[model samples]
Target: MEHLQPSLTIDFAQLSEAGRKDENQDTVGARFPEGPALATKGVAIAIADGVSSSSAARQASQTAVTAILTDYYATPDTWRTGQSASRVIHSINRYLWSQSQNNVRQEGYLTTLSLLVLKGDKLFTFHVGDSRIYRLRAGQLEQLTRDHNQRIDKNTTYLSRALGADLSLEIDMESLETERGDIYLLSTDGLHDFIDHRTLTEKLQSSSDLEALTHQLHQLALANGSQDNISVQIARVDDIGTPSESDAITVLSRLPFAPLLKTGQTLDGLTVEKILHESERSQVYLVKTVDGTPLVMKTPSVNYEDDAAYIERFVRESWIGSRLANRHVVRVVEPPQTRTCLYYLTEYIAGPTLTQVINERAPLPVSDAVELAEQLVMGIRALHRKDTLHQDLKPDNVVVGAQGICLVDFGSCWVAGIEEMASPIAADKILGTLNYSAPEYRYGGPTGQRSDQFSLAVLMYEMLTGKHPFGEAYGKAMSLPQFQKIKYRSALQFNPLVPVWMDRALEKALSIQPGQRYEVLSEWLQDLKRPNPNWLTNRHKPIMERHPEKVWKGLAFAGWAVAAGLLVFIATR
Candidate 1:
């Protein structure tokens, strides 16, 4: 719990009333998952309104609301907001439709369902039929979901899409970024249809207690002559628990910088043995504990002593490393007790960085390079699983130890939940090496797991061919036109040992557009080992398409030869 922070804290309330209807056919509920699930799955709120014409409408309303609220949490934490909620809605719709088919007299189970999931600082909305979800932010009321109803006249309308309306369901899903103090409202048609937007806005502004607001909305719906069951749910964002950038910078800046250590110099209980590495970023030293346990102590560069952002990044790097337990990631060791300075320690790996290895052994064996790439991808996959992007993924940030590959450097990491909070860090700033970074990162756009995959493929290309795909021009492009003009050189041109299929896979992963790359790191790793059949077709592509520069140069040479022959013929004449 000390290492991890809860991304969201919310207050929620739900109420359902029969109003003027003989039977209460509306259902509304909200639930916050416990412990780890709360952090991973967040909270879910749902409201459903049953159709008056169907005998099994009540069951459909209750079932739809219950199924989504419970099953949405059951989905894998790795799944994105849209995927998890959409899958649950589809499955519940199928069940409702099957029950309707089984009973002829009961007709079809029909209901309008609107569900909202608040995870971290994001809101996921899933809706079908006339029920609605709305959000109040910065004193403005915005309708977040669409009304799935067809109007024939002023007073006559029918639900166009609802649970069990047909064997197949069409659910409207959307995700919105959330801010602290944002209030969300989910309501059945009985409540939303009767209460106008102005009235709803007035009710929300008048109350601070969510329970009181829900009651007020229900009463107003009934007062306005709601003749059907009324149900409403209100959710207020209380807090996003992550620290702000300024707060983090302030806290980390207070720590004093560590002094350089000479061989055999003692600090606390660890004795420095040798200088491992040095850069403008930081210095690493090989050290030994009092009991002679080997370790690596990293101290921030003296140059950044007054730089708050740099200090904050260094501290965050240690925090991120401490949380990761993957074999291929460098392990950050916790201080035995309290530390005296800003430096952090890690379990030392007795090996050179991947950059050194690549330089020392150019054009590594095909199997060795592929195997190394697979291990490196595994490390990147581990970070991606936790919704973290190692923005600075390159050969220099990876170490080849006796055990295997170990990913280092988290100064440029972007954590999903943490980044959602108020931070001093600029989200749009380009991070990572230019040659390896994805094109999107260059333009100040959001980078995803795919961006990291781009970096990995670049490293793989370098390991195999000792050359960049687009050469130096790719990294120097300042505009979209310049970027688009950069050509990709085949790995086989540099090293003929690389298989055409493998080179094609690298080309796809190294696509200028992030969407053109592999969806997952594992997929690219698999392609490296076993060639994809789709890539086989790419091998037969025209020389101009596969290697544009080669064809262009050949055409230019032929044109020059023809021009020279014409000049000679004219001179002789």
Candidate 2:
């Protein structure tokens, strides 16, 4: 009772005659320890109903809840707010299902559940069986989680995707945005079937006393004829207040793991010479080895040892990038699996950002801009040939050195066909910049080479014209008319000097419908070879450094040393 008191925000009033066939099942249905580690904005709740036909349901429910909470808290840092909580729950479901199947007596021993995980302003809810999730916002009640019971002709009693009943599950992922004053309630069907949303909302609306409110809600569920076990996990969003500046540890240099990693200190034979960008993830530096070869060492921020998610992404991106043998994409060396808690290494290129290059040389001559586009397109095409999608393509991600444009940061790129791909920016899922994201990606679907192409087209337009096709106005460009009518075409009206073919090429690439646009990468190739280069001019002043060939030479040498040594050893053997 005390555990429920501090964690939840509800008041249960007095109970009357409730609709239940048995007297033993009249009380609230919850299995929890008195002491639970408090979460910032999440509720660790577990619930189960004892099957009328089997005695194993009680033990099954308790074991199921305990296992779920154990794994939920044990989650690595890589499992953060953006990931699907349903995936986590579904994992639990599989465990519970397998456990229930091993014993014959517990054959039908199963409990329905609805679990809620709230971290910060993000809410992830997963429900199996008849349990539910309720949200009371703006004084209006909304039942967010749906029930699985499938009663024949009438649609009431039987259900699908419950534990111990089947092997796999089709879980519904109910994700929502939360504010400071929102109220969330998670309970079983016993509580929901009896209490209506309007009545629940009225009792749960922000009140001076929550204990009294909780008692009131409890009494009402009992009064409504609740059969089976009843339980509630109510969470009220409270302001934890902001962290002070002193709370933040400033990172301006390489993160040292042990005694010291200072300037001139060499790691893995590479001397730490200069610091690049330092942040919460890693301390990037321009490091050189004993042989006078320079490389970029991304030493993990001290935060990495504390945050598992950052480590996962850093390791994943580094490993994936290293296997790729392409000129345009920055190469990562060393096996990612061998990476320590301290740092990962990558090939360094001294060049200006495409964003900077375009800034200085906007409105490039038709021929040169086309050449840049050709390289960019071919680089992307090579990556695609390997079935990789550069989910995040922007001026920042593209490096313009002496050789050509080098795409940096495979952090958001993925193996093309995975379901849970990382987004490029902070807005929505299926990640990429808001101005460049495809309509399908913003919704919900596996974004492939085509979607990446759309982003490339946007960046191409920006590179040529020094302006975004959608610009800042596209944030509000969610309306159908804004997308279908007033986008890239208007840019042509702004600069009539842009050829009709170039304008139309950009328009076609930026098409709202993916299939309607260029169905082939060859289309981008065609655009790159087009005669009019003013579409994206390359004549801006000196944005990039004078030397790009130096980097190409270094990479070439690194490759030969490894290859020549292999050949010599083989010949000797």
Candidate 3:
């Protein structure tokens, strides 16, 4: 069906081999909402190795695929090609986590997951355990997802991470720029054991016909005497993509930028000092205007690197930052476009990274952390009013600048652009960081302002306690998808500097379950200002961050009170 874009051909096959001692555990790929075609812009493929050790492995396999497929189809159209597929899988994570929680018989019903989503040929992949995504480009196959279970020694395969075991699990997301003739082969470790990429590519060479090729590949896996549930999905790009609707929606406007006089290598009549930061994709420079006004100038990574897609994204981000014009956000100003580059000038920030500050002090003083957190919440409120979500909010991205605490790094910010950015697979990958990512992110689908709140809670938690709730358990810094349920009670006992009110407040803000987190940044800010001993932190722990009720429940209840007041006055008269 050639309506517009080039036709992308996909073929998938799954098999249960006799050597594994598992029959019903094997499952195959099909579009969710139960259909043959994926209407959503990308193709979803996965290889789930159900726990052969568990009794309910068969049912677990079915549940995992169903959850993953449902998430793929239900993805909000707002995501862009810039994010990851791990987010969609996270949506699936909650489902599997909750399902296993209820059924005791399904105890330890875990699986190794390798998920690949294809958008215009770009591959977004996430993996846990050993399932793999391999790309056959120019006769070479590159293994994209790193296996959780590394070979600790030559003889043994030790598990680092796997699905179903943890209350929540993490999946990896990385971009693979695919070409038109490129071949992508996704398989379970069962298939990888016998047929390496060279053999797989050669076997796939004869079958240009999608379904026939899938069948031949499955037969080859069986011929190698593979033991386990084996699955393979093949996709040939066939065509390249230009830009999504969101990509075109970048903000384009000229604002008050000092552009009065310029001979060359200068903007707004300033002398061109030198380039600040430039790569193949973009360039930034530290320069001064004629009067010695210092400014940081940024342009596309390079003329070629500053291709249509990258430039548009950078433009969108910079434009959003300019319009936000918030104290906590870095102010962006437009620069006169020269014949060579589309330039942007901004206030040169003077600040250290929160990460760096944390490094220097080991941990911040409690009062300072709370003071800075309040400032961040206010900044977040401003961002929400502008309908922007700072997708990659991490300690490094935030600045404890001369201006107090300012948020930076809008590079992965999520908001509607002149074009659409929310590609199906990238649903949650764009906004926020690991350890702090919302449950909705890992599970997949539309993550809006509430997702930002989840990240906010992480920051706030760090403020109240000298440590990150999730990052603390591991001796190392922290792992992505940290599963420790944050407890304010535990934190308060560990640190004497924390206030009782803050302990409860932080508990509410940093609830691992979205339902429990503060629904509105303002609500939390209000509570912060009031310093209430009886703040409803614990009572409202299980709130759906996306639950509209948090926004409207008060108004609806107030409406009822007004009506009741009128009725009582009439009755008294």
Candidate 4:
């Protein structure tokens, strides 16, 4: 069947046969979920090759192929393809392993599994054992998976990893962008070992039909004297659709923004209660539906009416908020049934921004600061787990509610999967605040989860000390040297209540170089609660090393004292 959409189209086919074998022990299958599932889950294809040594090996192949096709669709639609497919593969491996244990000879039901999942414009690959998945594009064949086999000699080898081989499975996974006219080929060893690259390239160049290509591959394998069952699957991509942000920009460009909202004014079924915030990029308003449910409406700023990048980011903010459903992250509300203008709604959080809390309540208690920092880390962890980075994490972007802290702005968030797709936005521009931004950002270095950790550490230090680690020195810095010159004062200088170990933790997170910073958010979070013995033992730093200014003043004071004592002795003599 053909999977067709306005922007994306794909066709797939498969052929399998027992070659020089009494029974066919290989299984191959493909599935494309329809409707919403099609959009969310997309398509999946699986191939499994059963071992010849076992009696019920065919059962392992059939079970793995069938389970992946059926259970992958049963997974939560919101899940990313890699996560969903891996979960299903794990379950299938366990079931096959258990069946082997119940057998009389304990000769396991062994099989090799390779799976490919196409979602949006990206392909997710999962592999275990010797089966292979390959991509043929532009007359070149690229093997996307590694073989799990141990070679004893040049002529002999054995499968090192396979389904039913062990209770625990390590499946290799990778994701890549799919281009138009890309052809993906999957096969067992029977076909790949027999078909040479030249012949495969010739066949692919000659045929346009996926079904015929698969059939030709199987026939070639048989003609080349393959002893095992031959199986092959082919998928051809015709087109890829515009991503959500691009689509949103197209839809919103035709619609104009509603006039500035005032208290008691109504727009898009939401009654304006108050103006929440306003900036050059966007405006936020406290609004309520007719049912009295509170909501926060965010509208694009009139200043960015002609700016495509700004508008895309504004729309992407809502898209990101909708995908993440954590208590610490702000939730995006569905659009009203009827809308009069371009704006998005979010659950109205009743609390002050962390900036407000820090301003009015400067130098918060150590426990209180730790508590808020912990909550913010939870939100950062949520983003990181999804392969996303909140490039702009600061006190202003967080809300301090009674329930706890919630991270608010996603305009500067970077999602890994989405970033791989083509977009009008460019990466040269830096997207973060000055002082809290990691030093690498100022120098145009790549940012990742560690970059967010640096920003989080800046926030934690600011909460305790009421000052930025680098202060105003980081503002408008041009070069890496300038960033390296900025001094990071110990948090204890401002708040003695902050333990020495806590300051050291902040010190590492506040490293000028991204590489020197804490690699993971959890490491810094753990350090805040309990002191690391290594940190404690190494805390004895010289005054010049710890506080340069203090060291100079102490030296000047000693000089003045020595001069005054000598002058008194001279006068007495």
Candidate 5:
């Protein structure tokens, strides 16, 4: 039996014309991709209407439509529809606003935009200004967007919100469940403002041919005395093609996991040179191609063969690694040949793990620690730019090579795009090693870029002190109260060579509350390299708090001297 792959299918048509204006200031576009792109990115339809008051209105509308159509597909497939569309729209708005600012005539580039995306069994809508999106399902017509316009009088009105109207844009977005046979309509104000809702609904219900229907709507708008550029777009859902959890599992498990390999054994044109590491979840191998080019191959363990969630995560790790390109992050490589089993390869890094380095050379020099910190931040920032979070940041996941430091593990990464998609697999209750994880993960609080900052700070403290920032009790602290009881052991206490300002920076990054941490990783790195004037005020604190061990030793010496004086006095008597 041949299995058919699930996919989203749609039929759409669009038309834009100058009804009474000298030039058309409305734009409409639709993209229907096939195969994997259709399944991942779905179908997109956008409509934009330029405000007539602006001289650059046509350009603004065209740019808004074109930017969303092209850039939306360029985003990582892991991102959800809203996240991807919103990012592209915001960028377009910024460009249009800048152009308007530079215009000598001061006529702003402004337009209303409405975007509709059909993915899986859902419809996602992004709207700004007075452009409207309507859906007809089960013989009922419903408007999915609100007009962003304010009226000075019954006959005069202006758009209250629009792209390029301001430096920052606030777009209205919504998601609704979709059904096959549902019809969606997108129209500019020129058409919707002139045609009544009842007449539009009646026309939509009476037409089956989308191309003719859109043309009909345009002519009707002009007949109704519309004095602006007119535009209309119509799309009908042919198939929902919703992928169930089992479908995801089936797709991911097409290739079987490879058995544990021995040295000198060949599979798929690559020979296993040595086993690098093995755990209950996965196996890492040092492999060489037929040409003797060395690489590292990671394969899922057979222990999770029946676990769909585990299999999805294992495959996702490879997918994420292949997309990231950074000098400070390990590069996932393509296989030398077609693979017969489930496994992925990466460029071989010739260096010890950060953990191994610490074991051999604890208390790394301040300069070396600072340099490594900068590299790590660079790598993590790359992931952050793509809306990814490296949930785990520890010495074991970092390799110190001659090329510099490279973050190596992606199994624990969290991608915002993927999270937005519907999934049958439950998320892990806790991600990353408990010792380096932030408190939010344990307490079920929201986690974001700040969570990674907390983990990075822990790594920095360990590099300078050869110990965890919260001591041995941190890893065991499971509850909020337990975490609260655990206090930070400053790096200076273990290595006096660490600067006071640098230690203070580490303390701030390692704050138990995520809000207390630096707003960005770069700020923390800056504080580490330079002294913060505010931290200098700590010098005025009581000496005992700053140097408790020194104070205790001095007190012990004084007590011994007093005892000796008493003994001498008694002997003389």
Candidate 6:
């Protein structure tokens, strides 16, 4: 019941001054969150220096610093640090650029920004313009950012890259290993230009107090006659915290795996009503709390008790499921009592799996199939929005009930944020069902949202026609050549009710190459809902190709009539 403690900790301090300038155009800020956020998002420190020539330089600098500190935390915890920071920075750039363009005087809003995030055992840096980030460790000082200014002369230089400088912005990003005693310094050109790296490194090494060090750096820059606004920020890593994998294992291994349960068996105050499902990796039991509320309890199989990677994944499945809240996704819930073993609970759904529905109702009505597809897409989009991919999207993983289609089973889910962390265990490259997996998984090609799209398309094909788009050969095809030899069969071949546009959409989504698939899931869903303008030509195809079964049936009837007439004529003669 204890919260995940903050594993990453740091000593941080910052200062900004106008120096000789009339107004301070430099801004600095930092956020050291407590508890899970600190462990997930880490500590954020940022410094921004406004362009002296711009009319709104002060506002630009303040906005840049404030936005990074605030918006970075607002991003999904499942997003990689670079992904979250880049998206926030890009949005800030757009806002500043649009504001400048709307001004009557055509004045610009521009600033140089440097952000340093201490996450886990790593440091991530994002930089633009002349602002710099330096790391001091073991008496060695290294500049981690390159100035974006172009030198025109000895004393004159122009910034080639800065926030709001143009419609598009290019920023530098880098990641490096961090040690407990590592000291990082972020400063604007006002400070770095006046003070040399040797002086900065010496000061950082000599000082133990980061607060006093920041002020010392600022005053030193001012004494050096910095003509512009000066700002300085420092962070000394107190702890890189436990490595992610180790922390994960420690938390996941706290309790032994729950023993197999049967009806009327109780553990952690939840009594098992029945065995719901069992597999090589886990067991799912329908359980009830003392209040009689039904829930699904998933426990790892004893076979995997010694498997560190499997145990980590099993724990993370519960972690991931608890975070995702969507009508079409099964909800993982906290147990009424503190868990005494390695198992998680979810709200029980009284419905059959999609596999059962398909088996009982093959060739479902077109409208019914489309409706399920729409709900499935919603659930898949929810996962994608969190930077998580439902790599194993299949009928067996989906449950259809009165509430709608709910996606279950996250053992194969891939999270971008988690993937960024270093792990001692190698992840399984192929986790999804091969029959429903995208071709990229087999070919060692890149996979992303599009990969999920391919899996969803296969599910859709099965729902509508009770068949795979590429037939049974698809599940067995492992090589590019084998896949290339397989052709997509029309859904209408089995289900005459499928519209041509819908079939075309399925074909595109099921493309052997990931690039050929829909760029987004919504586009494919739109095509499935209505006739695509581009596919209107499909309706004009010859009847033989469009309705081959009907054509063959008609030919058979005509031949039978002719044969009957010839027989009667020969008998009469």
The order by descending TM-score is 5, 6, 4, 1, 2, 3
Could you tally the backbone clashes for each prediction? Answer: 2, 34, 37, 0, 2, 0
- lDDT string, candidate 5, 1-573, tens digits: 001124667888888998898999999999987765675677899999998898899999999999999999998876778889999999999999999999999978999999999876778999999999999998899999999999999899989999999999999999998899999999998899999989989999997999999989989888899998889999999877656767767877789889999999898999999999999999999999999999999999999998877777777788788889999989999898998899989999999999998888879999999999999999999899878899989899999999899999899999866665545567654379988899889877778999999999988888888998988888887777888898988788899999988989999999888898999999999999999888876463689878899999999999999999999999999
lDDT of 3 by residue, 1-573 (tens): 011132345544444343455374655565422121232246677667776676666766677777776665543433342332455666666666666778867565667777776655455676777777778777777788887886867887766776667766766767666677777776776677888667876776666676677667667777898765666677666655443534332322122222323224655454556664445555556677666767667655444332434444565566567767678887876554442335567776767877777667645677677688788887877776655677676787678887798887666776642223123112323434565666566545347777787677666666555476655442222323443433334456557766656666666766555666777777776665556757544443455544558658877899999999999999999
TM-score per prediction, in order, is 0.72, 0.46, 0.45, 0.83, 0.87, 0.85
Query: Which 10-residue window of candidate 3 scores lowest in summed lDDT?
Result: 249-258
lDDT of 1 by residue, 213-264 (tens): 8888888888888888888888889886655655555666666798878899
How does candidate 4 score on lDDT?
0.83
Per-model RMSD to reference: 6.5, 19.9, 20.5, 5.9, 5.9, 7.0
- Pairwise lDDT winner, candidates 1 and 6: 6
Model 4 lDDT at residue 130: 89
| Pairs that collide, model 4 | none
lDDT of all predictions, in order shown? 0.82, 0.60, 0.61, 0.83, 0.88, 0.88
**Predicted candidate 4 versus true structure: per-residue lDDT over 1-573, tens digit per residue:** 011122446788898898889999999999876654555666788999998788877999999999999998886443567777888999999999999998888778899999998776778899999899989888898899999989999999999999988999999999998888888888999999999878877787788887878888888898899999999998888776634555545655766776788899988778999998898777899999889999999998888786667665676677778878799999998867576676888887889998999998879998999999999999988888776788898888899888999999888888764554345344434468877878787787777778999899989988998898777877767688887777889888888889989999999998877888887888898999888776766346665766878878999999999999999999999
* lDDT at residue 181 of model 5 (Cα atoms): 94
Question: Worst ten-residue run, lDDT, model 6?
Answer: 1-10
In model 6, the clashing pairs are none
RMSD of 1: 6.5
Stronger candidate by TM-score (1 vs 3): 1
